[model samples]
Target: MMMKKGFLLKQILWISALIFMFGCGSEEQFEQTASGLEYKFHIKNDSARPVQLYDIVEVRMNYGTHDSVLFASGNQTIPFQIDPIYEGDLLEGIMLMHLGDSATFVIDTEDFFVKMMQSPQIPDYADGEDKLYFDLKVVNIITETPAVKARRLEATERKLAEEKTIADYVEENNITVAPTESGLYFIPITEGNGSKVKNGDAVKVHYTGSLLDGTVYYSSFDRGMPITFVAGSGEMLAGWEEAILMMKPGGKARWIVPSSLAYGSYEREGVKAYSPLIFDVELIEIVD
Candidate 1:
């Protein structure tokens, strides 16, 4: 089968753009951290406040390989907690900085995509010896250390915190939409004219899943592709199964999944037990 010229052109342009974005950094002046990650400080601040664990830091970040620019968040300030989810994660890069500091980090490409992004498989473009680069500038930092917040690890405390967290978020964000019976907020951001998703239908979707605090756990965009799966299959979280059923091809929505409908009591390297999650999904199509 012949590929369409327009699609082929887009693919070529995407590849070119990916390859053109990152700088071939010099190893000189780079310092190695205990975790095997290397970093170079472009701009450093000595007197400003330093980031601590659980602190919510706002930073301008763009990450990619020396050849490919994967995800460049444009001029946007992203706020996330300073907890390390995986070895050599974004946390490691942020921890070694103070307010107003700008730095570039060199980390293992496979470790980042496999451990941090939780990508099913590494993208072919990022599967080589070139390391991943993360350029970040600290904009703001709120010191919310576990001790400062008096956090507890008990499941009972977690249950209460989970409910309050959702409630506070909804109230502050002015989210007036009601949630489903399972406490899943199934709100559509855009409408779709295509066929509605059915149980056995094969569908492809682009989604970014994060914790309630803007910490992205997974993003298909970062992977430079979408994910395909059969609807209602147990491959997805329970919240996704219910939310995707309400969407159609071309539709986009946000789902606020409570811990009850999410990974309740399921802890892992990158996941916390009974953690609430948010998924921003774009249903691409219902496969033929």
Candidate 2:
């Protein structure tokens, strides 16, 4: 009986040892440290296109340090500004680091803005939130660095400067409008009894606009109706807002818009930089 009891105890010890080993091996270990940041990646395509260097990516990241237990949480879909450090060409950073390798790089927001401005790429503010960091790793890659982050900043700055010059040229050349403090000029054609335009009025008016060189930029005659906009709101440019105020339902007039009141210094597809603009506008109807 003594030998039998000793054998049963040995069998129980062996079973427990096996169970312990199995538990440890099953636990998943990450090659990248959470470090307090999480990148929630969504694949739009299972066999997705290769990630480019300058291509804007939509990533969901928890922008905080790993050491903090309580973190600020929010969702962001912003463009990733790829610089030259990645050598202007690479298939994907993750493929270079391997499928599971991860790393973090802390970037300064103010400095980022200054750098972007230096290139003159005036980025439009989607909502005006400032400063962000990017944490990335290669998931898959078929190529290595060689693609260049194109220089669009200088072109953007040139466009903005040109628009401003256009506005200034109109003003300096005796373009003739009764100016207001809000950077608008009004020239009235018809004297009507009704209010110029109401807050909720569905106003319509035909309009034709041209550059200083007699190049017609836009014309409502082609569109088949007058342009409509809400008054006292940002629906129209500064010049348009001021011009409409001087019109009645059937009034016709002209407006010389400065670059400040138009597209600023930014160049449009066909519109060159710093070109002054002219508009011969007509108010046809106001549907209240």
Candidate 3:
């Protein structure tokens, strides 16, 4: 009987060992940095060249809580210059990876939360026990020279000034408008009479887009043809899509689009980098 009891105990111990080796021990696959950041390589390309400080790198990233994806840059990669002076685990992990490498970074929730406190999109239910995970792929690396760096810095400064101008205009005008969660502000000029515009609907609109100082950049009237496009098709700026969806046929409204929702830091045609745009738009019709 004692022998049988001993045999049963050994069997239990063996099963527990197997479970630990195959399941809970999976965390051991990840390597820890000196700062306690953990990362595991999903794909490693040892032959690919690595990047140095100040090198511009294009990376595709998906970031979220362990259980849910909050944001993802699908297909479109983001370009950023590596700044060794910047302090963050994400940057630290990225610096360790080479082009063509894909890795998952695990960051402490408390640290991530503190860093992300300024962003309103963070869910209220987030807790310190939870971890933030980032899946990153280094796509491309570009060497930055002194002239290129100077140009980039000038553009960045211009963008910051433009944003400040927009904020000052908003305050001085005492503009009372409905602000979207994404920083767009809409002031209804005239309510529409028909159904509200929705995603997948074909809509025609006449618009006059201008800078915050009321400098007209583009006008559909000047082209003599109203612009027509599928709503929410991503064919237009993010601010335009958000505002159009709220309007009905025959609606007229003024929209204040922040630069982040507009051309970002890119200068396109008449729009400059970080320009907050003002649009006076009339939703003429909604077809389909």
lDDT of 2 by residue, 126-228 (tens): 1143333334433333332234222345434555675465466667777666556645555555565566765446667788778767787677887785566
**Please, what are the lDDT tens digits per residue for candidate 1 over residues 1-288?**
011122211211111111222365467657888777788877788888988887888777666767656665555565665667666666777889999888877878766644454332345556665587777788888867665455425544777689888988889888999988879998789989766898879888998888888998778878878988777544555577778889988999999998766655444334576688888999999998
Q: Which stretches of candidate 1 lie over 4 Å from their true place?
A: 1-24, 124-130, 145-288
lDDT of each: 0.69, 0.43, 0.68
> Candidate 2 vs candidate 3: which has greater lDDT?
3
Off by over 4 Å in 2: 1-178, 191-193, 273-275
RMSD of 2: 20.5
lDDT (tens digit, per residue) of candidate 3 on 93-170? 788888888877786665553332211122344543467677778888889989878867876786768657767888
TM-score of 3: 0.53
C-alpha TM-scores of all predictions:
0.49, 0.43, 0.53
Error of 2 at 281 (Å): 1.0
The CA lDDT at 286 in model 1 is 92
Best by lDDT: 1
Residue 176, model 3, lDDT: 70
Better of 1 and 3 by TM-score: 3
- What's the lDDT for candidate 1? 0.69
